[model samples]
Target: MNKSVPANVTIVDHPLVQVKLTQMRRKETISSDFRRLLKEISLLLAYEVTRDLALTEREIETPIERAMFPVLRDREPCFISILRAGNGILDGMMDLLPSARVGHVGLYRDHETLEAVEYYYKVPSDIADREVIVVDPMLATGHTAVAAIERLKKDGAKNLKFLCLLAAPEGIAEFHKGHPDVPVFTASVDKKLNEHGYIVPGLGDAGDRIYGTK
Candidate 1:
């Protein structure tokens, strides 16, 4: 992690994560490969982000005797996808947590203003009680994430975390400013954002790559 990144951020620096992230960064990687890599990386990220989930002991009957087993103490968490690109990461995380509730916070960044404009928002009615993990592929200008989290908080969501594949120092800083209490989880934090508000040396536009829009 870079010194400029917030202390609240957690970088999943596993060797497998680094390798797949490097492959995703390559321009030669096709849409199919890029999408596949994101899914694989999401699984790895999901594992790390959920590492601190609460657990409790449950006594169950075995063939010969009773045994105490560890099981999640709380209900399945909810995954709030930040629209199109987020769905890529959301899909993989869902594979590992099929029972987890799903939500969407639709937002788009204005080209000239570079501000996030929300069009829709929906989540489990009990969002205030359950853990919430917000997923988006890139943390570019950070406005989208900041705006999304703001909305979630307004809807009574108290426990929240942000997850992404690639991040920039600028984005992380901006994000921290907005939600200092919320932690960020990512595979890599890049150098900076370009003049166009894109993460430098990032995997290009994640939505474009994921849906072949470019």
Candidate 2:
């Protein structure tokens, strides 16, 4: 919410987003509740991320009379999820853009090196022609986000945005250094990442919290 935020980042600090983020951050929050809150907060984040979507007028007949309605210029935007954790945000993003085409990129951070290793990736053939939104719940070390974006770019993606639930300053810096053209949207920018590369004051491992795997 601060006007001093970097030009490339938009923090959705709305009351509802903040309230839900608080609930999600608690260690006592159950997996079910955490998952639900992530989805809710993601929906709110989506509203801001898509604020500049292009629209065109279309004539449609209402019950009373015909009228022009504004519809997305491109009916389908590309939604790419950065693996298992990103799937959580993808679910909520889809709720907002049900018709958007979906893509998946699977990458995991190496515990020792904190580097992202890609295992799987598939995207729409027309990704170059559509605006792409990359979803990942936590942007901690940022290797994964950077790697994912690079892969997308290599595959012809041009217009791109990155969305995450929580971000670390280290991660944001690294991300921008690699892809300054892409904008980032997040619910909260936490203090910092610990030595192990986890965001301090972050809601633990987002994938673990959402899936109860840890």
| Candidate 2 runs further than 4 Å off | 1-4
What are the per-residue Cα lDDT tens digits for candidate 1 across 1-214?
4556667999999999999999999988999999999999999999999999999999999899999999999988999999989999998899898999999999999999999999988889999989999999999889999999999999999999999998899888899999999999999998889999999888799999988998
Colliding pairs, model 1: none
State in Å the error of residue 14, model 2: 0.7
lDDT tens digits, residues 1-214, model 2? Answer: 2234577898988999999999999999999999899888888888888999999999999999999999988757899999899988888888998989999999999998999999999999999999999999999988999999999999999999999998998899999999999999998888888988999889899999999998
Error at 54, model 1, angstroms: 0.4
Model 2, C-alpha of 143: deviation from truth (Å): 0.5
Which candidate tops lDDT? 1
Candidate 2 — which pairs collide?
Answer: none
The per-prediction CA RMSD against the true structure, in angstroms, equals 1.1, 1.4
